[model samples]
Target: MNLSEFMNTEIVAGNTLWRITGLFGLLLVGFTAGKLLKFILSRRAEQLREPRPIIAATLGAIGRAAPFLAFALGLAAGTSLLVLNGASELVGTCVAIVVTLAISWTAICLVDAPKAWMTQRAGQTESKLDDMLAPIVSKSLIATIVVLTVVQIAQILSGKEITSILAGLGIGGLAFALAAQDTIKNLFGSMVLLADRPFEVGDRIVVDSTDGTVETVGMRSTRVRTLTGHLVTIPNGELANKSIENVTKRPHIRRIFNITITYDTPPAKVAEAKAILEEIMKDHEGMDPEFPPRVFFNEFQNSALNLFCIYWYHPALWWDYLALTERINMQILERFNEAGIDFAFPTQTVHLAGDPSRPLEVGVKGS
Candidate 1:
């Protein structure tokens, strides 16, 4: 018998029987196609070792999708056959199933594409931002797709109008608004942080009292990997309002040191001391020449003369700054000892009514 004759005979008996047979045949074809596609993709992935996760994931996704696409097309073809044979109800059901499968497949593929792209790109750079954001983006895409798929399924199952559902949602929207107030605030805060570019991942920053390298910026919170080796999660809203000190961006660091010498040191010696300090700073390789060092005899007290040394260092790394300061301080001590300048210590002077050798006289009789 001819292909057409067989299909006609099957449909003439009962649309349900014909549908069952056609569905099985389509499933078989889909299974075969899926297996073949999986084999081909697996071989290709094995050949390309780089971007292993992305390549393997993408290939797996494509392999899985092949079967669904084949099944959808098969169902559509079967539905068309049923319609030609005047089986309206069966054809309608098949059409709905096919449509649902098509929508779901499309959504899955759309979500997967972005994840694959991000995964592939993440291999190229050392950016902490890219590493932090990749998984977030992937999960968000998946969530959005799932939500859309559910909405589509609801529309198909309930046959409820979209406008009616939207109207219902609008009526109850106030509750949702109230529930998500903080969430919305954080969302906007995150956007602001991104646009303002205050600091980025791997940047060393001080937010209020918390000092750390920014690990990630997320939907609600910004994570910092503190120097103390702890992960701190700070709300984006609070972070936006707080004072942020971006230490990494500064080209130079200002360092100030105070030296106190005995008040007995003469003014000429102080002048000599200032000259020595200037020479020391000038000769130092770490000091920035653009902003020269200043040595000021700031103040004089009963016990000590306070001298201030202010200098700047290029490339403001903490370790480098500390090392440079230590060197300068050591040189200052050596220079002071060599020049016969003594650092001051607190001292006290007392006035006595009588000498210890001469006892106090009793004045009661005269009084």
Candidate 2:
């Protein structure tokens, strides 16, 4: 048939406009069906206290697949009608567009589904970092897939070789690397932080005296909530280079208290003081039994005998440690008072050979 006759035949047979209308109608139906399915699945899932994860996963899969399936069938029907109308080239182009769109949409939906499942599971487990990491990983995967897909689609449409494009990129590799140096460093730093797990969210850490609880970890920087109630952002690269002290992970803390008494206090009294300290340590609940407290007469100063008290306490918390130390200090004071041992303060005695009279005679000597 002639081109004009063929076109007239297609219009008369309703193959041209009918196919386009059917395609759009099917897409709308798919969207409506997907939404309804999601609602039903969500309602059913809420009925379960601890819903089986597989149920959510199945629902998510169905939700993602239903639209694509409907669209595919619609496009197939539409393309067949167009081909019957002798619009073979148009059908081919439409098919290619549908395939590309389907691939992109399916990839995005697949990425989103797993991410949602993981996020839900993480929420159930109460993991703080999951919320931050899940979106990042999901988006990164989606971005990479999109970039690759676009490149591939471009190559397919233009009939250009991908190898040539890659070769051209290789030529500019050095410049690209130079520009992305910091980005690469941060990315690697983030990976190292995740693998090593030096600190997790909510861990109290001291990095070069910037003490805080980790709030979030990102690709470029880590956020911490300081004791002073301010947020601090440290570059991941810098954080990796510095020493990190995770105080939250420490099981016990060692504490030292030094006291000095007048040198005139007898050795027997010093021994008695030590015994009293040992008793106090034993009675204190915070003291660790595995590492008992010990007191020693360390040195003799000009006016005082210095005693060292070394102990390990179950420092489960920062404030608890301070409280325990205060209790020990108060107990030590009470014990010293009861034993009549005085805590020494710096003192000086001026030995004067007729000092008061000599001060008055200074003027007479000058005369």
Candidate 3:
């Protein structure tokens, strides 16, 4: 139509062509603003070390958001030119509702961008736990966003703040709290385990009476592989309060024990035994040389003489320590046999101290 004819046409009842032109003008301005915003954000995206997929999409969404909002506002205002007296208020409320939803979704997506980037990078890491967490964290973020979005939608539709809804929860909130107590407590306990890092997967740990290697840490519990090959699951809530002995974190494994020699063993032989242990420890590469091996005549017992022995080994892997200990014990036994030194064994001597007429009474005393 010619410009004059278009200006004379009615878009809606009592809405002339000039008002329609104004709406289009507002839309054109909004479109221009959106394009400018996109150009600005594109420059920022180029500076990233590794530009993620969400960077472009998020920037695009944000760019289009302004124009979409402006267009909605202009359309709602244009409704006033219609014959309907309440059209403007109704359309404006609808526009506000739509904008609220769009804003909420955009905010959620922007927050999720970094997490998406992290998920992509997590696979490249050597840690299996981190690899597993990628999907778990992603899903968790999705669930959280969904819940928050539901709340946002509710507030927008109901036109009531969340605090007012909460205040009216009354008994329902109390019931929910009671039901979720254990879950929340366990959740916090898991957080503590993650933060404190008492032990990692594949590390041997002793908690309470249970001893095993940590297999995996889950949200509610930690799985363990025992030495006997049994799988044990301990709840994080219980684990957090337990005393954890992380064997892998130690600098050295200290070996302490008592070895007894028969009373027939001469004092010179006892000294020789100490020298033998010292020489054995010195030759072993795994043994800690900084801390000298010690063998001392601890005490004179009824059956044998006790020698207290102390030694330590570096980079304390349990298997390494056990293997070396076996070798040392065998060598000690062979040397003792060659030198005619006997290991202590339990023995007893019985004495009868009573009247001759009475039957023999056994009073047990032993050495």
Candidate 4:
């Protein structure tokens, strides 16, 4: 057969040979073009990444999604040449679904660019609000894209208007909302937490009985890494209701020290003890100028004299405060010993009516 005759020959499903060739030819061409474009964009994106990160990231995202989109488009175009009478609408609908999904997929991929940019920008700032908000915004955008994609696919498949579909979805959504009350509450609670700025990520906080460092604030729950190294997930709804103590926000740590001395010590020695403590705590390490160290002989008990001391340490760092406390205690011990002062201990004395040369006499009464 001549080339012209072969071109007109009947193929499978009554499609002419030329038409079949054209369909396959378009498919191959699309795939090849997609691959070439992806390679070029990927290389160029790499070169531009340092100078123009946002643009580079966007191009990279598109490059990653090129193959799938191009293949879907090619299939849609090729199917138009087929002579399937009743199946035409079905095929078209299927292609439309694929294309919709492809576009949505690309959109989702594109979200990565801005999401990363937001994350990078957030990291540069001192405020943690941006850090907490960036992920939420990115996830919300992706979710919106997915929902819209599903709706579009539904419209294509059912051949229904968007208004009708949305009306149906609204009724379904109401039932869903009613069924998922806790989830909704948690979502709103998360929003409240964000708005209130109660605590940020990495802040050590005490919520009710749970004391931990905030690890993450998510839609439903907040994860806390406890002191004992346990991870606790608290629902945002409940967390919002609880009182929160943000330990990380404290300006200083206050400490009250009580030093006891033996009662046998004379008034002069008691005064000296107080003076010694005042001298030992004077301008102590980590002490805040606004909250100077105070020392006084505040009380007298049966066994000892109570010396009260109050001091505030700036910055509220646990390890540094502990070191300062240890040094202060050692200094007090050394200073008191040098002054011949004895630390008080519990003791008792018993007296007898008749002992040694001492005796007791009682008067007799006649009735």
Best TM-score among the predictions, by candidate number: 4
Ordering by lDDT: 4, 1, 2, 3
Pairs that clash in candidate 1: none
Number of the top-ranking candidate, with lDDT as the measure: 4
Tell me the tens digit of each residue's lDDT in model 3 across 201-320. Answer: 778899887888888776667888988889999988889988999987899988998888888788899888767766766647576658767877889999988888888888887789
Each candidate's clash count: 0, 0, 0, 0
The sequence of per-residue lDDT tens digits that candidate 2 reaches over residues 273-365 is 878888887747776667888888888887788888888768677688788889888998999999998899898766655577544333344
CA-only RMSD, every prediction: 5.9, 5.9, 9.7, 3.0
Clashes of 4: 0
Q: For candidate 4, what is the TM-score?
A: 0.89
User: Which 10 consecutive positions of candidate 4 have the poorest summed lDDT?
Assistant: 354-363
Cα TM-score per model: 0.71, 0.71, 0.58, 0.89
Task: Write down the lDDT that model 4 would get.
Answer: 0.89
Q: Which parts of model 1 have CA positions greater than 4 angstroms off?
A: 1-143, 349-367
Residues 1-367 of candidate 1 have per-residue lDDT tens digits of 7776665564444554556577668767866786788678767766654546666667766766776677677666655544344556555655776667666775676566567677567667765456556656765676677766666665665678877766766777678878988887886787677667788678999987788998878878999989999999998888887789998888888988878888879999998888888888884666666788999999987778988889988878889888988888898989989999889878775545576865566466853
lDDT of 3 at 23: 67
* Per-model CA lDDT versus the true structure: 0.75, 0.74, 0.72, 0.89
The TM-score obtained by model 3 is: 0.58
Error of 4 at 48 (Å): 5.2
